[model samples]
Target: MTCPKPRLQALLSAWNAPQRSNAGFSRVPSTLRKLHGTAKCAEEAIDTSTRRHKVIFSGIQPTGIPHLGNYFGALANWVKLQRNAAPEDELLFSVVGWHALTLPQDPKALQQARMDMMALLLAVGIDPKRSIVFHQDHIQNHTELAWILSCITPTGKLRRMTTWKTRLAVSRNANDESEVDDSLLNTGLFTYPVLQAADILAYKATHVPVGDDQQQHLELTRDIAEGFNRAYKTPSRLFPLPEYMTTPSKRILSLKDPSAKMSKSAVDPNSRIVLTDTPAQIKSKIRGATTDSIQGITYDPVARPGTSNLLSILAACTDDDVLEVAKRYHNRNHGDLKADVTEVVEETFRKPRAEFERLRGETEYLTQIAEEGAAKARSRSDATLREVRHRVGLA
Candidate 1:
């Protein structure tokens, strides 16, 4: 399965070749110095020659405003990755509009949410000049690749996916899939992982940072890649089976219900702390956060999920160990802990929230960023898609 030249090699070649006269087309820098300053570029974590290139790809749904869970779960990690990424590495952070369509969305609201997500991403330290940041649907190649890959994906494999079941249950407010009828499920919801696979594979991504829950989808991506290689009979595999770069499993639980993960879709507005929440709002939510009436603090998630959740938030905000934070509060009461957590949460979100407010009003700048990012993304992905089409006998 002889694959076409790796995406990075193609990009580097373009970088070195003479500049193109095409409007809006310019060579991307071949070094990390272009993204970050020379002094700030950290020593490459992986040997570049052995690795060739690390294509870091990840995306988030632009369903609505991101919350504390979104920040910590994905956004914060993205910033860290961008900071550490090498010059040769390509980092693609997408506002995945296609994935958001698995569930119903208001068109006008969805359009605005996409813009809001881009502003928040920039405000939170995602450097568009350094990384490719754009809306997923802007590139037609993603869904196009998904359809191609779907030919090799078995219906049974898609049915085995657990997320669809959960989405169905959530749609009807049921406790589990058992309560929701299968007839109501949509094809997009059932095969969401295929599109997710397309998102990663389209870039020929080499590494993806994902939490435990998302691990399953990445595995399925690998399966699809392998299946495609086998079916095509390519001398070298066309798609590189991407590997997971496991991040700290920091699952931010819902403020209202500690048993559940924090989510934008939760019915209760107070269930999560959104990036736009004011300091007063953060304080109010923390103050009302459900904690046990026990006299003292302890870090037992199963026994006292509410209090443990607060301690977890405090530790995450302060970069301290949760157990250590809990030990400090051993002598204090729930109110003291909540107060401290509130202070930390407010302080953590203060700058980003302000920056978001400022960026939101800059419509011209946001549009330029999106247009430039989409161009870069398309340039790379379109090449891969063309190779894919030719190999599959479409071209």
Candidate 2:
């Protein structure tokens, strides 16, 4: 009998496997195939022997220590994917320093943050042996491929990207006003989506674990892959358009201002819970979290963002449905919920915190892992780049 799938395996299996079209070519679902003629194609993709094992890829910025939102929204999902992946499957998690450069960062702090991020990835159970973990900047192929992809990318498409628009909107002018301004928008931020596409394309990633906010970017990646294939691929497809694998976890919000996502840039240190937070700190933050004066607890996110955020955190920690978690807290006051949430948060973060502290000091080991991972990454991309160079007449 087939073994049971991991909790996360089911979350991603729908589109992770490639589907065969009427033309007998395996591909990700595209607008042309789905909405155009050939309506008789198979609705689902199968993992045939001809197809390679799933190559899963995702990246995270090395800004600083990740908070609750970051953990639930992405990193925790990577750990689950690693634990569940087939032995033959390839998984690459990159500390994307290049993406971090979209915004200005302190030189020394950015350096430290990249190392700390690698340590944190290890702390959270990303095995270097099982999953390829590397610094994106260490592999020059990413930038080279990004530059190649950028040459064909249309400026109109980039400008139409909601991420670009949002970044421009959030960026401040000479003054600190957070309006829809573009004076400070940099070319890096504007073209980062192409780099993102290159990151996935370099690995020929079959499935990408992405959050809802990033669905558009993944769509753009698929578009870029198709564009390159149409322009360059002669007989066979060069890149397998990657499909998105979303997390089941709800978006965790800020404790201080439930309206916004939990951010490291928030003025209040208590706004978000970091993995390194001590038990006392977790307790204080949870206890001080902004909640309603309602009679009882519920998970109406729009109506009760604060209470719902705590429940979301609790549910994530316990691996339970947020609605079900709220059922147990309906009669409880915010104080009771806060106490329980605090305990669970502390328990959840305990091991990772200890591991990060221990691993952070092992600079030699970290460097070794980083170097080895970079080599493996380069090896993986060598064939793709070789073909890319030949197609573009640079070989």
TM-score of each: 0.86, 0.87
Candidate 1 weakest ten by summed lDDT: 22-31
Clashing pairs in 1: 1-234, 1-235, 1-236, 2-235, 2-236, 32-87
lDDT of 1 at 338: 82
The residue-by-residue lDDT of candidate 2 on 1-395, one tens digit each, is 23323532332233235421223222444533552235433232222324558889999999879999899889988988887777888999999999999988899999999999999999999999999999999988999999999999999889878777465444442223345556667888899999999999998888888887888888788778878987986866688767667787888888999998887767688999999888888988999999999989999999999999999988887777788879988998998888777766776787799999999999999999999999999999988999999998999
lDDT of 2 at 89: 87
**Model 2 off-target regions past 4 Å?**
1-52, 168-180
Candidate 1 error regions (>4 Å): 1-49
CA error at residue 83 for candidate 2, angstroms:
0.5
Tell me, by TM-score, which candidate is best: 2
TM-score of 1: 0.86
lDDT of 1 by residue, 88-197 (tens): 89999999999988888899999888998889999999999899999899999999999999888999988888787888688667875687778888889988899999
